[model samples]
Target: MSYTFAIIGRPNVGKSTLFNRLVGQKLALVDDTPGVTRDRREGEARLGDLRFTIIDTAGLDEGPKGSLTARMQQQTETAIELADALFFVIDARAGLTPNDRAFADFARRANKPVILLANKSEGKQGEIGAMESYALGLGDPVMISAEHGEGMGELYDAVRELLPEPPEEDEEPEALGELTDEEIAKRPIRVAIVGRPNAGKSTTINHLLGEERLLTSPEAGTTRDSIAVEVVYRGRRFKIFDTAGLRRRSRIEEKLEKLSVADALRAVRFAEVVVLMLDSQTKFEEQDLRIADLIEREGRALVIAVNKWDLVDRQPGQIGALRTEADHWLPQVKGVPIVAMSGLMGEGIERLMKAIEEAYAIWNRRIPTAALNRWFEQAVQTNPPPAVSGRRLKLNYITQTKARPPSFVVFCSRADAVPESYLRYLINSLRSGFDLPGTPVRITLREKANPFAHKRKRPS
Candidate 1:
């Protein structure tokens, strides 16, 4: 297996610079602005002779709980568990700050092997800041200038020290051309792009694949068939389903259109990442949120893309205003990343791909039994399942039944009597507890038979 290394630090710390340097491509969106990256971005990276999977995370900052920054912190923490090692980063030019210390403390708690980096260590001005970083206490800081591509040799040495890549004999070779069946099954990631009729769903998929695999038309509901396309991204093979335009039953009066709507739903059921697109002129229409709600109900990962953004008039407050509006109205899908781009112009298309992969990771996530049970106990304490006929619905235990639209089964005493409202509550609790937002979660209740209440075994 290739060694996975995560880059983590506070905002504007040159983490994206280092990521670009290591990836040998501009995979991450880098700007002077802080927090341009709210979702975790991944790329296949190489440094000198070393090959590894690199994760670029949102910059951390200590603030009010549940802030976007705070949620990004949770994302990084999850990445740490998924990685073989870590590269904790700090801004040498800005010098060490309180937030950096807070993040450093969080990394220390994980007890994972870490290589601390003091970024922006090119000029003599950063020396003092580098000196101040010794206080991180995780170990010596590796000084390097990510922007100038200096100190890469030193970076390679540090990573090789802690977690060496698995030997060639053990390492799974990258598929030569098309993905082999083994490789496909090993990572069966499903991505579904859905939106109201004519939101550029087909256009976006074509942009991502750089091909006209799915039919594109100006007419609403032109794509009556849900089309599936396969593409390999950054060596990871993703099976994408471009769904038909979903509309209300009354609006979709035609028999064929109704079937297309059903096809869109079936596409959601098997998806790991569901991208919900909106036409910029009509962002977040009632139908848009309803589609998002459907994605959430299915437990598939979710991303919102405002298409045809180039045509919109520029305004300073537009981005922030839209994001705030989403947070205020779409609380159920907290931390969902919305990107403004033109599928026609290709502006910010790469960023959308990065966000899609991040959501997919969270969707296929399977928690350990111990942690899940702990969360389950807490949820039960918070709001016990509703009673049926004056007797409490006895939910004995719960376990994930599958992934790729995570489905779980909860063993209970009277499954048939379980109210849909109560089931929804449990599903919401699971979503919040597990850091899964904008994704659908499916929970099925099954009754646990009591042998004592049944008749004795009949004679053969």
Candidate 2:
């Protein structure tokens, strides 16, 4: 029976700062730049013994309909509609501005309990602003500094007064044991849709959701935060993340864009399967390859989605040509899944979902030790390790240490002397032999230690 509070204010008023403070984490990005948050982010928050859900939203602003700013305001309005109450924050140091007065009426229109917070009230100057905030007709203002953690007690009291009484407690259910593999598989799959700016990542996700759940525009970098939404495709649950478009480092001039890129990279690392969306017109470009390489380096399962397929001129064997190009560009992940589709028109969506599930299954695949060793024997015997410095490298055996991007370790006589070319050969052979395609495979080399070496070598 937790209540939800949506923090709303004009830009640069410390709304995100208060959100981080209540959630006890830096989940929301905070910056001096106003409108740094373009989407509404929700988190479970706690204050003293009280627990509630908190939503951090974009600052309220006015823009023409269909513009990005207007869309942003719409997202904030959605958050307000979903919340049980509103935390109308104001910059105490800046005093009340016309925008603040205007938006105060906006918050009033929501018809929910609103807690007026006069933030940044550390010095005497902030006190003047706090006094001015009282004239907005929302009620008394709680003077607090979200950064320095002041006035939280008063804010907590205001929030508790608005919260409804909790329902009667019920008998607690027995704690469950560890989940089995099948049960774990039943859980939602975390898939991240990532790519360069204006690559239709958000559009694809919106198509899957069959609604404009996320704010989308033709302009690049419209999405700043990594917003995750849950969807069911063919009865399979997937928690999909819509991330900001990644650009080249040289082009990332603004501090805000840098933060957005970092957030996107974090999504890649957090996801189990990543769909690298590419524009059909600019498929296999340098930036696209770089993004794919980063995904491979992160060891997440990879799927290549050629978006805006309708824009492309159709030709015979085009799909096969795309596959060939993918293998040529990303040989490390040979046989990766590639789906060509128009995100805007919702074409090839079923194939994209199918490819994602197959990639996930392959990513989590594990090979039996006996079969792995047997395949290793044949692979090593067929293409034996090359001798270096007139000494033959004796390869011993291999074993799978883990799965989820299957990793292995091979014991050998001279681990350091093993050529990368030989390792690549073994990796490719392992992929073909064990039916592991697209997922990143890791192999660590270890030198077999001599048992009698510790006995002083007989004073040789």
Off by over 4 Å in 2: 166-178
Residue pairs of candidate 1 with colliding backbone atoms: 298-440, 299-440, 299-441, 300-440
Residue-level lDDT of model 1, residues 91-208, one tens digit each, is 8888989988888998888778889998888787687888898988988888899999877878878887865534343366676346764655567477888988998987887887
Best by TM-score: 2
**C-alpha lDDT of candidate 2 relative to the true structure:** 0.91
User: Model-by-model lDDT, in order?
Assistant: 0.78, 0.91
Q: When superposed on Cα atoms, how far off is each prediction in RMSD?
A: 21.5, 2.5
Sliding window of 10 residues with minimal summed lDDT for model 2: 167-176
